[model samples]
Target: MKIRKQLPISALIAASALISTQAMAEVFVAPFGGYSFGASDFSITDEKTDELGSLKISESNHYGFMAGVTTKDPGDIYFLYSHQGTELRSGGSFSPNVITDLNVDYFHLGGSLYFPNGNLKPYVTASLGLTQMRPGDNYSTESRFSMGFGAGIEYQMTEAFSLFADARGYATFVNSSSALFCDGGDCLWSISSDIMWQGQANLGVKLKF
Candidate 1:
């Protein structure tokens, strides 16, 4: 998949807040769907993929929702939940003849700051929470602490409706000292525990309360 990383922190936060009233706005909800891009290959097990081999995960689409409070100062404090997955491919001459699957579920406490314009809003977001990775079949699952950030723009359609688009990245941290899988006296690193990161492009509709 062809994907470009977009990392931008608004340089005009102070300059753009001249129109704020500092009053609290009502609650809001944003439901979104988008395409997910997987990070570069990494070993699930302790063994370095360069020495052993690599597992390639196919980029797939994901969907999620956010519930938050939008303030007149142009900020959002929201809870976000997203579902993501990919197909697993191992790099080797003799590949395993098994169908493997990979999935991730994210639960985050996220926040955003927007350069609020009359009808066009540009924003940046950050979040930290839990990431759960499930490898298909009987493989043990991996769950770890994760963090992510994003930037986007929103265009208001009416007093209570808006459309927005954003690009974001989430990373899961799971490290091991030694391989978790052992075979006859030889141990392979854990397949369920590894550092993983994912990027996404999303478009969603927001409803104001």
Candidate 2:
């Protein structure tokens, strides 16, 4: 009878310890704004004339937010959503000269590996996600698989807040089909490349809860 009573008490203590350890894990959200550049240029060709042209996505500002939970390791797993509004310009007689209103968005699931020292932590991050490209007017939106890799440093200001900056490079796989950016049988552009690339630099504040 005493052993049965002691077993219940022991189980209660074990459960309490597990809960306390979980409670010590940190949850954080970071809202960030950044400049994105180095978007790859696509080659365009006139099917009948055999003339070559070029298409470019302009450099622009992007914003995003990340929410994550710290693991037992000195790292965290996060979900990131970022968006950029820019222009697509055409050169060498590929028809429309410029699409002034274009948007690029990324939805990513990523993780960071951290090296901590005092109040500062330097980390490397990698993510895989989808990239959505939307152009204004009659153009259709295109979604492609993408990945990113980056490195950054964070300075902890207090127990609940920190500042961070990161530079990341993204690679988006272009569709193999010719139907991209098309609406109602009219196509805005087509390219032969398998991948498009871009780079970004971000600064943000991390809030912990």
TM-score of each: 0.76, 0.88
Q: Please give, for residues 1-209, the per-residue lDDT of candidate 1 as tens digits.
A: 12322223233454355434333566899999999886656555334442454556578888999998886557888999998776766654326333477787899998999997789999999999998867775555657899999999999999889999999998878664544324444554544435677888999999988
**TM-score: model 1 vs. ground truth:** 0.76
Mark the regions of model 1 whose C-alpha exceeds 4 Å error after superposition: 1-23, 44-51, 92-99, 178-188, 191-194
Tell me the deviation in Å of residue 35 in model 2: 0.5
| Error in Å for residue 117 of model 1 | 2.0
**Tens-digit lDDT string for candidate 2 (1-209):** 99999999999999999998798789999999999999987776544465777777889999999999987778899999999999988766666577557899999999999999999999999999999999888778889999999999999999999999999999999864554567666664557767889999999999999
* Residue 135, candidate 1: C-alpha displacement in angstroms: 2.2
Q: Model 2 scores what on Cα lDDT?
A: 0.88
Q: How accurate is candidate 1 locally (lDDT)?
A: 0.76
